[model samples]
Target: MSEQSSQGDDDPGEPLRLSVIVPVWQEAATIQATLQHLASIREAGHQVIVVDGGSDDGTPQLAEPRCDRVLSSGGRGRACQMNAGAEVATGNVLLFLHADTRLPGSTLAALKRFHTSRNAWGRFNVRLSGKRPLFRVIEWFMNRRSWLTGIATGDQALFVRRPVFEALRGFREIPLMEDVELSARLRLVSRPFCVTDPVVTDSRRWEQQGAWRTIFLMWRLRWRYWRGESPESLANAYRSDVRNAQEP
Candidate 1:
């Protein structure tokens, strides 16, 4: 590495060895609370990175104080936003968390502990935030199935060694299914750990779309992908539903 590159690599300071990178787009509604939650779990050598994907809703400003740095990336998709965050992250490990998700402080500690002991990357149990029985059923089944099968999603908050992540060339900069695509790639190297602690994800999408419709579409998408169909089609369906559901 050149001198300038070496200096840049060595100068991130000690407080940012493990960083939590949150990607946001129009998430002004929950960014502060999310950062506040992250800050409450203060640990040395940990930093929070908020990569705002051109949000016009003031989400970036809301994330400013609680995070170490806020970058404005010109991406209209999660894959690009998160990849941008990873590009600027100074940590040895990266945790890709969604803005609508919340993890208990203990789980963050568990991730660091697991990263240290097993010499493996990480994932978390997935729990949905809502009283819908379908949410409970899906969350439980998915968590247990992941435990048995090692499949994971971005909503579960994937963690990995910085070099391993970079070596894989990072997440595919697709419009959707980035998590599933990345998970499929990660499976080639090692099985993802299903942490006992879970990350709670908001379920406003389920509320907007009927539970059965949402679940059916998700299953159809998964089944299609598993049947060797291209994931891009399923991703397009998912984004369509998401856009329609989020609209007034």
Candidate 2:
């Protein structure tokens, strides 16, 4: 489907309209459920756009019916796919959501508060879907770390005003750390409007690789990234680690 030609009005006096942009690859299994969960947002007059990164599966086909627009990323990578969706988004606020993440029930109310507040960007707190106590510890740290440093991961449901997003030129088309990179630039504009409500992210990765192993792997990756290691190298290392974890 073609993108909506009109860019929605950004009049300060008007109520904020959220445009939730989801980037997907081979996520057919979870795409439908994710979109279904956003039905309330759509019913409230918000828009949902799904960008596909050349998934050979029926991801786009499955998503097209559920969203306002389904665009081809014409390539892979979350940064690139999200940028493509943002380009055609008509809402004043753009929310980048992960395919495996579900926003809180109070999302609209939280966003309304954010819109009225003097903030340019923000992210939701996040929790894993796992019921284990370890998941609670992970969630606590994730939320606390984001609150202290003002850096947000994609799983946190990052949202920013369209103008600010445009000013930053959207997420950099990097192989990794795109969310962290964007957060750094966004911090120059304003402290993040941290929402107390949490988005629930799938725990499949942690379950598949083991929670402690996954946590250490993520910490090592972030540490290396902070040390100025190339994103390309980090991405390779991450993929290698995942592959190794999956080996029986």
Candidate 3:
């Protein structure tokens, strides 16, 4: 092999080797800000890749400048778009982030530090960006449930080593609950290390839908899903109950 190729083959030890992949659809309002946050971590050998799932809202254009690579997905599903981003990403680790979520400045460095352990596949705790007191209660419950069950939601900023992600064949192509499904599969590899440093996420959904109602809806959906209801069915129910529920 050529010298450059040999050097590239060396494992990334004690350095940031992460790719922040944001799969978006019609996220023009938030994609730019999310990319900007990820841009700050690029100096640590981390890269950002935005996968636009056939967006018509200029999301790709806004992401092109702030992120390292912006690619258009052939389909419009969170799982499919995330897998597409991973296919072209070069980092050893992949972080699947949402367009409405913002990570801290130390996110890349934290991931590198966590990578030193065997359980590198994990997610950060989440904080909702809303003034409602119920948001706090909901976030606490979400974080606690995740820590206890070792199953993480997408809003938590799920991440995993590239090899393990590929081995698990990326996320299942489901209409909803893809993150939960991936976490279940990943449990065979390692229990997710829930980082306490929270990722701040937009609380518009909870606010618009009414926090208590949204919480109950989610619980019902999960219970039905656990009872063998198809993701498509759950997705339909979610859309009927929640405004802008089709969003990724």
Candidate 4:
């Protein structure tokens, strides 16, 4: 949702539309499917952009045919990679999605509906990789927290107008919470709405580490960061393994 700033004052001919940017680093195993899903999203009129952050496993080549534009990223950090993708995107609305995410076909339509319903911007609900009841609890609590606080994450798939994104100068390029930092800014401008449906996110990291331990670490690290812990500290705490079946 936006304040409707003259409906594209700069482009009289182009209607404000959605642009989805997916940042990836060595996600070859999962990138192809992600791109295919993105390609299917075009039927809803959303443009998908992929920014490959020096993936050595031919991830860029795999995404080339499916994405409208596939560009080289500045670094392997998710924040920097996403910012690089945004730099070349032309859509009026930008949605930052994860490589392991599976957004619903109705997502773009829901975006239109939300934008028309209220003057706010937001993210969709989240579903975990497995049907573990515990994981479901995590997802529910996270969604509720986001709805209550307007704080969304990259994995939740954030969508914003390009001009607003540019005005905010995009992501902070930090190793952590690039999504959190960006969401904070979006909340400052407008409340983020939640789509009724959910987007399933891969829990590869959790799988690599023990799920319970990963969850505990995530909660502890998140609290630490919110309490003013440095990004490097959090990065050190984060497990950087990509051993799951879906990750490359």
Give the best candidate by TM-score.
2
In the range 1-248, model 1's lDDT, one tens digit per residue, is 00000011223233326778898989888888888878854445477898888899998888897898898777777888788889988888788999889986576556545554433466888788998677889888777766666667888898877888899998988765688788878777776655666789888867778777787887788788788776667777887877876678
- Candidate 4 lDDT, tens digit per residue, 1-248? 22222121233344547888888889888888888877767766668888988889999998888888888875788888888888878787788899999998777667665445433457888888876677887888888888777888877888886777889898887888778888888788877767758888997766666677777777788798889988887886664432332355
Stretches > 4 Å off in candidate 3: 1-14, 243-248
lDDT, model 4, position 200: 89
Q: Give the lowest summed-lDDT range of ten residues in model 2.
A: 1-10
Clashes of each: 0, 0, 0, 2
The residue pairs found clashing in candidate 3 are none
Question: Candidate 3 — what's its lDDT?
Answer: 0.83
Clashing pairs in 1: none
TM-score of each: 0.86, 0.95, 0.91, 0.87
Give the residue spans of candidate 4 off by over 4 A: 1-16, 117-120, 240-248
Task: State, as a TM-score between 0 and 1, how close model 3 is to the true structure.
Answer: 0.91
Q: In candidate 3, what are the lDDT values of residues 1-248, reduced to their tens digit?
A: 00000011323564547888999999898776777777667765678899988989898898788889999889888999999999999888899999899987667556755566567488888999998788899999999898888889999999998989999899999999999999999977888866777999999988777788889999999999989999999999988886554445
Task: Tell me how far candidate 4 lies from the true structure as C-alpha RMSD in angstroms.
Answer: 4.7
Off by over 4 Å in 2: 1-12
| Model 4: ten consecutive residues of lowest lDDT | 1-10
Ranking by TM-score: 2, 3, 4, 1
Global lDDT of each candidate: 0.76, 0.91, 0.83, 0.77
